[model samples]
Target chain A: MRRELTISDQRIDEQALGKGRAMSAGMGAAVYFVGVVRATEEGRPIAALEYEAFQPMAEHQFHLLFDQAETRWPLESVRLVHRLGRVAAGETALWMEVVAPHREEAFAACQFIVSEMKRVVPIWKKAFPLA
Target chain B: MPVSVLVLFCSDQAVSGCYKSAVQVRVHFYSYFKDLAGLAEVTESVAPGSRLEDFLQKLFLRFPKLAAMKKSALVAVGIDYQAGDYVLAEGDEVSLFPPVQGG
Candidate 1:
């Protein structure tokens, strides 16, 4: 089992994620989400945003999240990535992929992962208002 | 000699504050507070029976920006967030997290 979770600002490698999905091809289906940086926040223009994380704890929590999903579902793979530092508009902010024995489980796990990540992770972001 | 509480900031500065001889607590900061305080952690001395809220009040007085964020900030002891009146013990790690809005 992989223990280190990828927490970064670099763009996600969809091909790699697809490969991971393919490894579990016969098992079921894969669900994925890519969060992109938007140009606006609350209807106001945003220039760029800064993301910071308490790395050690955040990584630990992420591993726990993955473990929980695996325990709750017949999942073959789970991949999650989040960006840190300053990100410009239209850039990717985060991505998550999960492969489960069925579409329903995959979909549910994907949603749960993203929502819980936002609610529990020690990562925070600050948006800069556009001038 | 009385046990002195040491508050260490990310800036590499350490401050000695009044603390009870029996308890040593570490406080950490995030987001704007980390930036403003120029430190990731602060150590403070507490009375033997100090409440978490009272310790926080002392912190707020020392760091005005931290005080300002109190309303919206979330405080956690180690991995769990505790209530204002939770009793602190020696070597407890307290974290101050600003509102999080990450995907």
Candidate 2:
């Protein structure tokens, strides 16, 4: 079966992330990344942060990264979620989960996926730090 | 023809200002740069054949905060980062991204 990629702005669900992991169980290993909004920015208190994206381009890039991962590694499934709109401090910003038949390939592909996402994804973050 | 450039900043915050013109190129800013400018996009006209670095220097003059991040920031032309001296061309899409923190 072909695994589809997930993209959303709502809060990330742990159960959903777990489901992605579970889907890879018999396959071998899973790699996951959870990006959280920190409480501080440049030593200032961050009250909230808003994430904006060039939606169509960002989604296209997300799928492209997943395709790259699948080709580069022996991954059975991959799921990536990035939130849009306002997010409070200490909240999740993005999550990437990749499952492969081997730990090395899973770890490496996960790292590559996150780095590439940050580099190419047309997503921007604005922080509203406490005064 | 004058280059058409678009500068984008945070619309809600007074981070900086916005400039829109009938230029051929587009410039994008993200993170603190957008926050300070209070816009998400700005457009300007640049003389043809201007170097990307020169355009950035002009931007720094307009927005001093941009100067601070110059060393670490990355500039992309049509989705890929270009060299310092990359020449501005008609209809080129440029983007400025701050240091990314993702885990």
Candidate 3:
């Protein structure tokens, strides 16, 4: 499977993420998720978010997630990218894509990856309020 | 009974030269714990035979903010995730991670 862990200080490349997976003749569905930094935090207005991660550990966790996903479904590829440092409101902070032979597996794997990433990965974010 | 004494006791064990086999483990902190500790990493001197719980007790005593996150934090040694009962080795790269909120 084609898996990735990208950490950038700049805005995530939306177009690049859309083209991350190679079109396979056997694959019938491609599901993608992009998580953007929103403007509110618990009803409080926010300017942006600062994200931090233990790089080595985070990468290792991604591999573990990929392994689990592949074991549960027949997948063609998986790509995950996360932004670090300061990300302004409305800016994309994360990207995830999955390709499979059917929409059922593709959608299931996509949801699983996103949910598990939030629950298990070693990345954290703190919101900065609008002044 | 105080946090300070617990911290000093742990340090004295290493400083008094009593535990000649003491080794240093570098702990990298992330997220709110980093902000609270005001450091990205700290060197923890632990006796050679100590377990992960022993080291964490000293660590929590040194940084109470981390102690508060005991239930929510995740830990790893080197590249693999480890349980609190796992024994620590010399020069281990231990890291403490707060509950992830990433998407």
Candidate 4:
């Protein structure tokens, strides 16, 4: 898989991230996971969320997680992009796409990537609850 | 006889024949810490041979509101995750991160 990890303060380009993967004819499945800023947290109404990151190290962790994902499954392509700074409720904060030859492997790898990213990445999100 | 001369530089006043100096460590704040601290970055001076824990202790002292997060927060020196006891160096970039909620 042509693995890529990107972190930016600007809006995430969904189309660009989901497109242009050189998938082999044999590879048929593609799975994507987009994490958005929810309107509430712990039952409290939220207005927005502000994201911050130790940029360099966060990128490093993303790359490391991709390596782990590749080792665990047979993947065709992968892309993980996360946005930093203020993200209003319902806006996309994270985008992940995993491509594999089969649906099972694609789903599993996609889930693994998101979980590992949350566990290890240095990025953080702060909620702004509504009054 | 050949002898090596050692140089000592102190920023604090010498007392009772003892010399003391403080090393300045620059810290960068993020997320809620930034909101609480009301600033993005600040520098704190600690005694020589101070560890990351000591710096954090001093930080919490200055910003008591941040104390609650000490247990879950992560520390990074430069671009790598560092243990609490990691010795801090002068001009080293120290970052305090709240428990990451990113996906």
- Candidate with maximal TM-score: 3
Off by over 4 Å in 2: A1-7, A20-26, A38-48, A54-57, A60-64, A115-131, B1-23
The sequence of per-residue lDDT tens digits that candidate 4 reaches over residues B1-103 is 9998664545565644434566788888877788877788998877778888888888998988888888888788887788888887777889887877786
Best by lDDT: 3
Candidate 1 backbone clash number: 6
Query: Can you rank all candidates by DockQ, best first?
Result: 3, 4, 1, 2
lDDT by residue (tens digit), candidate 3, A7-70: 6677788797675568689999999998989999999999999998777777888889999999
Q: Each candidate's root-mean-square deviation in Å?
A: 6.4, 9.3, 5.6, 4.9
User: DockQ values for all predictions?
Assistant: 0.49, 0.17, 0.64, 0.54
Q: Which stretches of candidate 1 lie over 4 Å from their true place?
A: A1-4, A20-22, B1-20, B35-40, B49-51, B79-87
Better of 1 and 3 by TM-score: 3
Return the top candidate by DockQ: 3
What TM-score describes the B chain of model 2? Answer: 0.71
Candidate 4 structure quality by residue, lDDT tens digits, A72-131:
999988987888888888989998889899999999999988887777788887788886
Ranking 3 against 4 by TM-score, winner: 3
Q: What docking class should model 3 receive?
A: medium
Chain A TM-score relative to the true structure, per candidate: 0.88, 0.89, 0.95, 0.92
Once fitted onto the true fold, the runs of candidate 3 whose alpha carbons sit more than 4 angstroms away are B1-20
Worst 10 residues of 1 chain B by lDDT: B7-16
DockQ (0 to 1) for model 4: 0.54
